[model samples]
Target chain A: MPGAEGPVGPRTDGGLGGGQRPRDRRRHILGDVFAVVCGAATLVGVVALAILLFDVVRDGVGQVDLAFLTSFASRFPERAGVKAALAGSVWILGLTALIAFPISVSAAIYLEEYAAQNWITRLIQLNIANLAGVPSIVYGILGLTVFVRALGLERSIISGALTLSLLILPVIIIAAQEAIRAVPDSIRQASYGLGATRWQTVSRQVLPMAMPGILTGTILALSRAVGETAPLIMVGAVGFIAFTPSGLGDQFTVLPLQIFNWISRPQDEFHVLAAAGILVLLALLLSMNAAAILLRNHYQKNRN
Target chain B: MVPSAPDLSFRSGRNRNERIIGAILFLCAALSTLVTVGIVGVLLTQSFAFFRQVSVVEFLTSTQWTPLFQDKNFGILPLAAGSFLIAGGAAIIALPTGLLAAVYLSEYAAHRTRRILKPLLEILAGIPTVVYGYFALTFITPILRSIWPETDVFNAASGAIVVGVMIIPTVASLSEDALSAVPDTLRQGAYGLGATKLEVSTRVVIPGALSGILASFILAISRAIGETMAVTIAAGNLPNLTLNPMESIQTMTAYIVQASLGDTPQGSLAHQTLYAVGLTLFLITLSMNVVSQWILGRFREEYE
Candidate 1:
């Protein structure tokens, strides 16, 4: 519709302003310019990301070493490290995966395999979709009320992990559902023909077949959960944690929280440290995403 | 399709186990519904308490957003203005570039190029928002200051630009799917004529995928609205009623984080204001997401 006039009445504009051959030549030039511009625009994001990585690496490379990784947050920016936040991030990621993975897989199994095509199932499906789209901050509010206050978990690592578990649950559920659905139904029928139970067919045949996809989804979900800050901020990830959290009940901060705190400070040294912290976070995220991609490629390769 | 029941020859023990697992799975599926109910209940019940103190009419009509100020004005317009301004600014940047990228990928790129570029774009999506926030505050704002000399260190412009870059992948991927959804036959038909690549993409593919393209726009805008960490770190926490991105302003989610991080006592008006704002944010994103999904599904064309 946009360029409809181009084909239908190419001569109209030409007739009004210029000769036909000149107009066609101008159009050719415009088309080439448009193509180049579009191509350049496509790479703008990639370029921006490259600049970002370069900027952080330049500012942070001097600060990243074994000491930086092992030290705790300090008032002196030079001495500050992300030990507490890194441990807390690990704790949250592990616990969120522990809490969310089995439940999400089971939910996907129910939705894709067991639940009949009824309004209840439809409602559940819609709810999950809507939940996935809800802002992560809202989940933080829910955690503050239900887990922190009602359940008396305090602002502990477990509470943060539980909140994040809810935040990533729908994503995992949707991804797991997609994976489960991709498993050939013929495999299910074959298992059934062997007198296997429904659960037997799913756990033994379907889940194993869908395992790589599930793993890919789980890694991606965890990567997202790891990077999130607002909900953790809302649920009380500390600005400065001097001690590494050793248990679920321990107080904690995460990499994003540490980065957020340092960035907000006025000290130039803190900003550099924040850049270093960002480098660490990005490294963690990149590894996770790389794992997901490798898993997906391997799955695709096997399928082919 | 599933043969309506399990094989009759399955052992009774396994059948019992299957039924239990099915029930467990059903419960797991129901948990997401419960999450929605919890979110709504938390937002509404707390907002109701807030409204009992501050009338709904005042909250909706007043422009001042000084909840923490001594005067204690609880109007949300200032926050809304900031959120929309950043969102609008982000849409301005992301929409066209992302659409162009999608068009290029869908119409021009070879299979190998697409395969590499698609995941490269996803790498942008996988990066943490806090890192974007850091880049916005440290990198983008300084660039803006060099350009204008008057841009505030924590202005909305840098936040918007980084947030825009952050969301480009979402827009690009979604729009690419929409454009690719346009039947290849249509593309071939256009090419069978003397239409140039630009003409075919602009006139045929874009128009055919317009609904889905618009859906991507809506989705991208919604994501911008709900984004927290970048806005929080770079947009500043001053709730002000203005459209200028050069000025620092607080957004709804940022205010929620600010409010939650404070020493606001439980059941106090300041504390309750968090939920009220959360409710408003929830409604806005919910409507946007619903509208996008409707457009994506309703106007979508399916072809083998």
Candidate 2:
């Protein structure tokens, strides 16, 4: 009503300004274009990922029979299986988890629950962040010098696992800290008021509450360790081990290393085998991630 | 009601256990610290040994990198340049696309859209870098060759594109978290002033989330810089000091990998050079991470 007043300006055919309609139309068109562009980019990215997965699955599924799962690498691509690599991955994952989990969780607990506001804690926190960003290859070199060469561990699973454990420790610590920090302070106070000791309160109460997050983080970190190639390569993991590792001290090859060896070969058949290896690796990664997701979901449901 | 004989003995026993557990936790924290210190010590020691044989000037300034040659030129410039060019190209391709996708996911998309999009995006991150390396070598390189016949079969462009795709999820996920952290009140205020949705989002929300966005970008850059397998498999092993993305190039990580393939003799200058490169890569990434954490710590207080 105020806009229509004669004192303000001459009357127009509509309430909108003469230029407003075209501007609004232009904006709507621009918005649509923007939305379309964003949607397309996202869609394209997802499609590329899907295509990669599809190629791997298509090529690898054919080689994933029981024999392939159980047998060692064969002289022929047709006869080759992932038995050695699978066992190596399992061993590496088991050892890495064993080494990294306790240390990472304990560090997180200390930082989140016990540590006072002080410079030492700040320094430790800063170092953890920096460590997390160091390249896997750098960790590999460290492993080569410290574990494999300096300790004389040779090209064994122990060195690989230890290197991987170090590589993933920062990730686990960060994630565990986040989980611990998410716990409400009221629970701690309640436990303290009941005359429960700090250990009892943390282990039975805070830890149980943070279990799912910790597990998820550990699983994700282990998954990353499984896929990692650089550190293992540096730690002297063999590329073409025909026999399965007999023990922790024996030389081993992982799926990624095997795939690299195959892909680097001049033969097209080796390329196919590499694709198949990728599928196997993807399956392993997906299963582990799915388990983590399930655990997290279960925890969330019970937590509420 | 009188609590007759107080349970002081039991309480004291429990307190002793708690102290024991606390000691164990402290040990674990120390262990985590030890891992960091151990890595630094081992890398520095080995690198120092390498530097004794090869002058820092030669490592930093030499253009040629034919370590296997009789002449043994050990300049790191070619690998460093390759790493920089590939990472820069990846950043150029990933940044705008990732930021746009993040904006859509955090600002414009509905909850359902976001839920679907986020996990789909994460699938990109989960794909093994080795698989991406294969994709670059096979699919992307072939495509590039179709357009540019002069392009090498193992070209930096293919590696850069695949690496960009590989990093998009990381950038998008972190940036989305950043954008979503911006307070709603500022957005509401913008809306009350009659700003359009796009205007409110770009002008108000993005500015509010600027620090987080910058952190995400820095983190993405760090990841790109540290990436190994994809570049190793896609970019050829040739350490050429050329700027052409269509040609084969080598990264620092790739050179480390090439050195670790059992060709370089132990205690040789080339072997030690790997550690030196590792140290440089570690320092670069660690500094980025420290800067990111510092930024987050400083700015997070302002928001909270």
Residue pairs that clash (backbone atoms under 3 angstroms), model 2: A60-A276
If scored against the real structure, what TM-score would every candidate get?
0.94, 0.93
Candidate 2 Cα deviation (angstroms), residue B53:
2.3
Q: How would you class the docking of model 1?
A: medium
lDDT of each: 0.89, 0.83
Find the candidate with the highest lDDT and give its number. Answer: 1
Can you tell me which runs of candidate 1 are displaced by over 4 Å? A1-24, A293-304, B1-11, B301-304
The interface RMSD for candidate 1 is 4.1
Q: State the lDDT of candidate 2 residue by residue for B1-304, as single tens digits.
A: 0132488888677768877877777677666678788878877888899888889999899999888778898888998898988888999988888888888887778889888988888778877788899888877888899999999988899999988998888778888888888887777666555455666667887788778777877888888889999999998899999999999999988988998995788987777878888888877778887787777777688678
lDDT by residue (tens digit), candidate 1, A1-304: 7654443312233343645577567666776777788888889988988998998999888999899999999999878999998999889989999999999999999999999999999999989988988989999999999999989999999999999999999999999999899998899999989867788898889998888888899999999999999999888889798998888899899999999999989988999999999888988888887888888788778766
Interface RMSD of each: 4.1, 6.4
lDDT of 2 at B64: 93
Assign candidate 2 its CAPRI class. acceptable
DockQ per candidate: 0.51, 0.45
